[model samples]
Target: MIKTQQLVKNFVSYKKKPGIMGSIESLWKREAVTKNAVERFDLEIPSGQIVGLLGPNGAGKTTLMKMFTGIIVPSSGEVEVLGHKPFDRDKDFRRKIALVMGQKSQLWWDIPAMDSLHLIKAYYEISDADFKERVELMAELLNVEELLHIHVRRLSLGERMKLELMASLLHKPEILFLDEPTIGLDLIAQDAIRDFIKSYHAKYKPTVILTSHYMQDVQALCSRLVLIMGGKKSFDGPIGEFERLLGSDKIVSFNFSSEPSRDFFNAFQPKWSDNGLQVEIAISKEELCPFCAKVLEQFEVSDFQTEKLPIERIMKELMMRPELLNDR
Candidate 1:
């Protein structure tokens, strides 16, 4: 379980002016700029839930994660994780939580992955039997058993990430903080990581807080989504509700054998593909069937399909125009 009330993290830095003259004048007179990376953030997460924290760059998602995991202390407000203040750094609190950052590496580069894992086993004081069992099971699940003895620097990013995850979960932490776990991975590798996380959560039931740029990762693993914008919590709800934020209309795309005139589809707000052979349009549920039939009859259609509002589109819209949430 986790809870935060008016959680705020502020960062202070000196503002440096551009150019040589400006730089030379700043030795004693530089202005101090204070930024609230996370401001008045309030959140509560129950145990055994996979919650996705989403936002664009500089949206304070990482700041909140750092505060939650005790990597950094907040400027003001209260935050409690598993009944302990994270900033207290209690040994039991540390033991019960694990934070995995994709852009950061926990394993040594020159040593084999298993070698690093052994060090983690000692650090966590895990029993030999438990360590061996966890390593074997996680490696098998991630299909990385053969890479266990390979030097970390030699393995690909995907392989290294799998080993990193195994190392973090060795002690079975009660809460898992995953920051972009599938970042920079190919589609296959991304899917593999997502599937492994789902399988792990199902079997172990750990409380997971995931932050990812890839909506696919959120869609696959999280039932709840928390949207952060401009250092504030903008929305918190189920994935279905997040998707339906823009509207209940269906997003349908059609491929045409020949380019169709935009005028005919103008009323539907069509978004055409680069080659102009495909167009995606939003149609209200009530008009979906009739509109499709009309388009089929009017155009030389090659293929078409429909889908619910996409998370990526919603995120883009929100980032570009935060006012979309005014009605909420």
Candidate 2:
């Protein structure tokens, strides 16, 4: 279980003046701009629940995770994980949760992942029998059993990530804090990691807080989500609630049974141009079926399908919108 109240992180940024003379002068008079990575935030994640923490860059997703994991203390407010204050950095708290950042590597570059696992076992004071069992189980689940003997630096990104997961889960923590778990990997690797995560969640039911650039990760693993737009909470609820925010900018597309004159698509803007009268439209909330029927009355409609905008595209659009900077 995890909870936060008005969780906030602020940093004082230094601004440098251009030109040699100005740069020298700036040493004594450095500009201090304050940035709120997370502000007045409140969240509660129940045990055995996987919550996707979604946001664009600088939206405080990582900051929130750091606060939750005791890597960084919140500038204000309180956070608790498994009923213990996270910033206290207690040994029990440390053993109860795991944090994995995509860009950060925890594996020893020149050593075999198995050796690293052994080191971690000693560090955690795990029994030899327990460590061996966990290592083998995690390796099999992640499909990296054969790769364990290979040096980590020689392993592929996917392999390294697999090893990372195996290493992190050695103690079988109750909470998982995954940040961009599938980032910088190919589609095949992404799917493999996603599948492993899904299967793991089903089997172990660990509390998960995942922040990923890949929307598919969220779609596959998280039924609930908390969207961080700018430094504030944009939407907090089930994944459907966050998906609803993209409803206004939905898309409707279909094929035409018969090609009609330009007048068929003249009144409305067509998002697609083709040899036939088939078209797609990126429109706001409107009766898409009736609107499509108006075109269908004159022309035949085939392969009709209505789809909302992709989650990635919608999030990018929302991130650029200034109005979303301080969301409710």
Candidate 3:
């Protein structure tokens, strides 16, 4: 279980002057800018669920994740994880949660990942039998048995990332906060991690909060989403509810061999837009067939394509019109 009530975190940043004289003055009297990374961010995530922590850069996704992991204490309010205050940094609390950041690595770069695992095992005081069983299980789940003995510096980005997951999951934390877990991975590698996360979720049933710019990851794995913007809670609800924001309208596009006359387009009188297609029609989700029939009668259409709003476009639209993200 996890919950945050009026959770707030602010950063004080000093402003430096442009010129050398101004820079010298900045040393004596600093002008600090305060940024509210999270302002009264309220969250309640139950166990055994994956919640997408979605927002653009500087939207407080990473800031919230850090606070949950006990690495950074919130400036105000309460955060309780599994019945313990996270910022207390209790050893018992640390043992029950794991945090993985995309740009940061907990593994030793110069040595084999197994070496790092062993070191963590000693640090956590894991029993020999428990450590061996957990390592073997995690290695198989992550599919990094062969790469375990290889140096992390020599491994590919995907390989190192898989190893990082293995390291994080070794202690079997009850709560996991993954920030951009698949940031740099290609489709193949991303799918692998997605599959692993799914299977791991099914088996372990931990409370998971995953933050990423990649909408595909959220669409693939998270049924529920928690949207943040400008350091505030924008929305928190099912992903399906978010999809319905565009009203399920269908987009039908046609390619023409030549630009038809303005009169020809006027006859059809479709919702005029810049599709480079001489003509573009907006059809209700249920009226695709009739709309296509109406279009084909006039223009010499070479190709036609119909598509629903992509996740990326829906996200962009929501970002532009933040009211669309209002919580249910």
User: TM-scores for all candidates?
Assistant: 0.94, 0.87, 0.86
Best model number under TM-score: 1
Residue 157 of model 3, lDDT score? 83
- Against the reference, the lDDT scores of all candidates come to 0.92, 0.83, 0.83
Pairs in clash, predicted candidate 3:
none
Tell me the deviation in Å of residue 291 in model 3.
4.5
Q: How accurate is candidate 2 locally (lDDT)?
A: 0.83
Q: Which scores greater on lDDT, model 2 or model 3?
A: 3
Residue 12 CA displacement from its true place in model 1, Å = 0.3
Judging by lDDT against the true structure, name the best candidate.
1
lDDT of 2 by residue, 152-267 (tens): 99998988998887788788889999999898999998998898888888988899899998898988889898888777888778876666665554576768666756655544
> How are the candidates ranked when ordered by lDDT, highest leading?
1, 3, 2
With a 3 Å backbone cut-off (N, CA, C), the pairs that clash in candidate 2 are 257-300
Q: With candidate 3 superimposed using the best TM-score fit, by how many Å does residue 59's alpha carbon deviate from the native?
A: 0.5
For candidate 3, write residues 1-328 as lDDT tens digits. Answer: 8899999999999998889998899979999899999999899999888999888889999999988888899999999989989889999999988888778887999999999999989877889999999888878878889999999999988888888888888888898889999989888888888888888889888878899888888988898988889999887889887666566665566777666545544433355446545556555667778757765777677888875435566778778877765543
Give the distance in Å from residue 280's predicted Cα in candidate 3 to where it truly belongs.
6.5
Residue 225 displacement in candidate 3 (angstroms)? 0.6
**What is the alpha-carbon lDDT for the whole of candidate 1?**
0.92
Relative to the unseen true structure, what is the C-alpha lDDT of residue 170 in candidate 3, on a scale of 0 to 100?
A: 80
Give candidate 3's root-mean-square deviation (CA, Å): 3.4
